[model samples]
Target: MNPVPDLVPARMVSEFVYCKRSFYLEWVLGQFQENHEVAEGTALHRKVNAVKGSVPATSEEKPFKATSVQLSSPELGLVAKLDVLEGDGSFSIPIEFKRGAPQLGDDPVWLKDKVQVLIQALLLREAGHKCSTAYVWYDKVKRRVSVPITKEAIDWALAQVADLKKVAASHKIPKPLIDSPKCRRCSLVEMCIPDETNALDGKSAQPPRRMVATDPASRALYITTQGTYIGLSNGVVELREDRVTQEKVRLLDVSEINLYGRIEVSSTLIGACLERNIPILWFSSGGWFKGYASGAMSGNVDLRRRQVLASITGALDYAKTMIAGKIANCRTLLRRNAKIDVEPTLTELTRALARVKRCKDKQSLLGVEGIAAKAYFSAFDAMLKAEMGFTLEGRNKRPPTDPVNAMLSFLYAALAKEMTVSLLSVGFDPYQGLLHEPRFNRAALALDMMEEFRPLVVDSTVVKLVNTGVATPDKFQYRGDGCIMKPGMKKDLLRAYERRLDETIIHPVFKYRTEYRRALRLQCRLLAGVMMEDIAKYVAFTTR
Candidate 1:
């Protein structure tokens, strides 16, 4: 059965014909940028599309030429605005204007341009106009190329649109083309990163996809209010403010939904989420972990048993590696952000890294990790400007008595929730521990996994917020021997956290740039692979 797209813009069909990944990147990922070629193309499009009124007949002009003919067909769910529609009402033809020269092959014209005009022709046919043939006018060579609107070409274009609909259904970005020349001219080169990722394509045994979600490109919806209710309506997740609908998101576009405070969710929404396997995380009004709920687990039982066994008996090596990564990342953060001379702190962290390699058990690993953390936090106060008044005396959790501690603790707790979900998605039992002690309700494994990212994601974000005066002392309320964020501060911090997660960095192992959220998921998957002995050694994320 062919999947029909909800709406197919005729231009996107041309993009689909040109490069599938470009279409996915542009439409699905909502990513685009303007390069030289794109700017030039835009200028050309403006010039061609700006021809107002009828074309005056010259020696070189066609008998009947009209500029910018708009047409749509509800039956085919297609829409197009041809650059020029020629001939008469009885026998009209759509002519597309191309910025470049006509690309002629065994076929009459370029398939991308051909399919585009064919769509315009189809739309014209549905709108009660005769459209048997179409023409493409090339500006560069001043040539007119004819494209036959044959059944074979129309069927092929329809099939392509159906495939595009299937891609939309998945909500995952399609892989880049192998050895594509179009990549060189693509405006999204930096975003797509085809140069580095494409290197893996030639290999017979390629690495696994480096994201944890069922669909990596899907967006997460966060609800912070207490009285907000979520329900399912017409294949979309509806957010209501006390029974009045506020926002709606299609079910397929949501990867995860996080509910904070006393947000109410109906059973129908839960069932919809379960059917789609999107995890829902619950947090306190103050951004503390409350609980987690999700659909059925998808990891292998045997692999999980092996992971549990490793955590219980043989996790010291993994702990040492992860701790080393954490300490090294902490040093890097200090080196990058510290205003004063960071040499002393970096030297101490270097010694801690050396001590990590020699650690034979979890206790020694903790000792080294502790020393590195102490040095890192002692220098943390110097990283910020004095005007910001955000200072870290030490790493404190429970009450987070200071402003810096309050923000850091909240960020860490949020990070733990993300790591917990990521670990669970990759089939790891969050309660099992490698470094942190296992408790009945504690997500010890998630804590262990988040150690490396604490400095990378949380500390870096805190530094940026504090340095930029984005998080002020007034935002933190001191009461009852503890400091907590106000409502405004909480919103600002959530925004900061989400932005940080979207930031991309080159992966230490994969050597390809990926979002921090995807990196977190990738790390969990890599750990799972290590436990399953699919990979010889576990490599934790580290930064320069």
Candidate 2:
């Protein structure tokens, strides 16, 4: 099926510059993992995100508290929680906190990071913050560098977003560009296969799957040849069926046949095509297409199984309430001091629930969260660093440079993967999700379900791991384009992750306790029940 256009996310500039396969695996397959450099970077960022202080009167003077924080842009479709947003008593400067010492002003990623800052600058303007230039705070040098968000730079980001959308719309997977050194880190290198397959040894000839058609333009003939008629489309086709004269085409001598698009195949046509064994691409729309692909129906009928559960209202309400309850549970898991961190977000989460529940369709509900999550995430990022005793400072995009985004993208993948397994067990197809776009190989529905549980599972575990030292310096590595999980670290992380899910939580509605993993499965079954008119219990989950 052709993916509906515009459903895909408008990716940031970073994804295009990085390895396409990584983009495919991440943005497409939604698989994510973490390594060593990333873990340390997260720790370092906590300080910068919370750093108090402003800007110098001149280039030499010291600075104080940042005024404007977390600037975003709609046109560029980029949102960043900037480190030093307010500047020198007046000007609106977008300050980026960097860990690597300092480099000649020409480094590519530095330049790229700058473009993002520039986009934020324009966004700040759109959001009503007056600004001229942006700055990068280099932790190593302990100073900020000036950058110009010139017309040229802003112009570049605009062009890039357009290009990104174009590429996203074309769902084809092209061959790997082995020429780029970046390919070394691609997750699908094992599956995509760089080397060409061996040719069949002509010494042992194999039969072709198809026979050429006879008609010059129509190409309607199959493999059969009734007579050795010379100039039979200038090719020889073996004959199997009897030569016959058809009323429509007059007398024609032919044998077995395999026509192309020239004819539509039906029971009559299939009988002929099967006698001839011709392959064709079957077409359908909507659930019919789904049922066809599943091979559960023979005619035009589609089998959309109804859930056996009868209390749909209860199940639906349960799904939403469980989600909100999970969010509340996460708040309890945070270190005591972080309780201060919970109140505002708890408010927003509640607000999002109202917004989420009020949603008339899945797409609108998704867009609401997409925007809400972007804004809401900045707060959580702050809470995570403070409670875990670390910081997450950096840009949020493909191959994240900031600590928070890196953690977020990785956690999103891990949590969603677990939910995919959960949904499948409950017989709710993950592909037919509400919030996320149905991209090739992407489990959109699974992503939608994962949103509510993110804080309870991934976010909480990440903080606990960092705070308790269960996940430490040696567990991460940063040699690649950016900090990523060490080679063997995923197994360890997943173990910790699974353990966290297995940790029991009191069920508010069930009047009992259950593992988070099982809870996820029950949620899916409840959603299915809702669609099948089996239950009425459904509520949008929020704070935990």
Candidate 3:
């Protein structure tokens, strides 16, 4: 039996025309960012295309009009949904509605927009319609720009369709354009890191991070409650508590399984998870990172090699930027949420930001970070609502003396796991460090990457959990020297952490809204870009 040929979406051709790297990121990696421009365009199309009752929109000059027509060409392996067709059955022209203003003659910026309609016309022609010309209506200008459907345009689009099919089969990402003006308006810029990847010197920079599909349907299973037993059953993983099945999910649906202390997992299940490339992370009862059981190394070896080399060569710049991000985020968080005046802390953070840029060595960078952390955390006590009974005397990690410190430590550990997973997904050696000291059997690179997120993720999460009464003193048990969280409390914190990761925020560089989880991956990819010298500067995720 002959295998079915792969079909290429007509819109992807437009993407390839816009930027080959963007096309790869979208079509291959399944990554996307939503921004105001994208939203505006979507809304505009929806409004224009939602014309009811098939009452064809006809202009005084043209007597025919049809909206939202689906056309496909099986021989070409292409499918398209034409926005508007404005001719008779045999002879028709495609009218594409764009949200942008009309551009003058031979503007390269509108080339992709023109190619989009040309592809639609090609598909229409293959469907037994004669399309000689296509029109693009600009919403801002209220003018329809006519593009002739020439032999050359048809041949170019057909070749691109073939190229797109090849790309689909090969699964190789295209190189990004360096400092392209078109990148400023591209929605995928944050994820693509065009500037960073394009800036890499082929000799010094490492290979760019490989693009991996992040399944939105996959879920993370948190075994928070104690006495829970995990086992394999009929290609599905079952969770039981007190001999009662609490949940059962097919192994395919699970991406990662995290278990707190006292949770038991059968060896069979562990092996099954590892075989399926699902990582299993273990946390202490008090939410401390113990270790993780994951599948064998699956990423590119050269990427790891480059990560080690780049960490040493770019240590100073990486260290400085990460610390600056941490301090800036700390100041922003204090100014926005702190009940008391944060003028002093903000001033100190400002000076620290300035000093961080001038740091020539890792030692100076660490010193600046230490000073910023001191100033930032000193004001932490004032930010908490007095009713919560959570106070932070200082940032204490080992055997946290206060409930706040315990939560912070636990949250930081959780963030570490997230960063490590993200780095691994992008084929980085999580043990190599630029900002943090590398230790035996430690993911120091994850620690280094998490520096920027400490204030943005952990600190903010703890503050919300306490101030909003989501987590109270009763949720934490006071031990001889430290505080511990019960399984139930861990469950609550897990819920909050997952929610925080799922929360969407606007990325400052791309001006696009992305989930915190995907943002972590973006940061990792950007770091890879920097290591490869694809970009000039590494921009961190800083909150307003």
Tens digits of per-residue lDDT, candidate 2, 246-285, equal 2232112332232211223235443443343222222111
Q: Evaluated with TM-score, which candidate comes out highest?
A: 3
* Model 3 pairs in collision: 196-534, 196-535, 197-534, 199-533, 199-534, 200-533, 200-534
TM-scores for all candidates: the values are 0.62, 0.39, 0.65
Give the per-residue lDDT digits (tens) of candidate 3, residues 1-544.
1122466677788888878878866665555656667878899889557543232332223346667777677677878777877776446788888889876657422777877888898877676667788888888888888888999988888887777667655534567775566776777766676654553433223323323234477778888777899999988999998989999999878878888779999999999988777889998777777778887664344456667787767667777777888888899889989988889889999999999998988888889889989988899987899877888988987788888888888889899989888887666788888878788867888998888788777888889998999888887787788777765667777788888888888766555566888778888988876664445577777877
TM-score of candidate 2 on Cα atoms, chains taken together: 0.39
Give candidate 1's whole-model lDDT. Answer: 0.77
Q: Residue 366 in candidate 2 has what lDDT? A: 50
When 1 and 3 are scored with TM-score, the better candidate is 3
Local distance difference test, per candidate?
0.77, 0.48, 0.77
| Residue 423 lDDT, candidate 1, scale 0-100 | 76
lDDT, candidate 3, at 206? 33
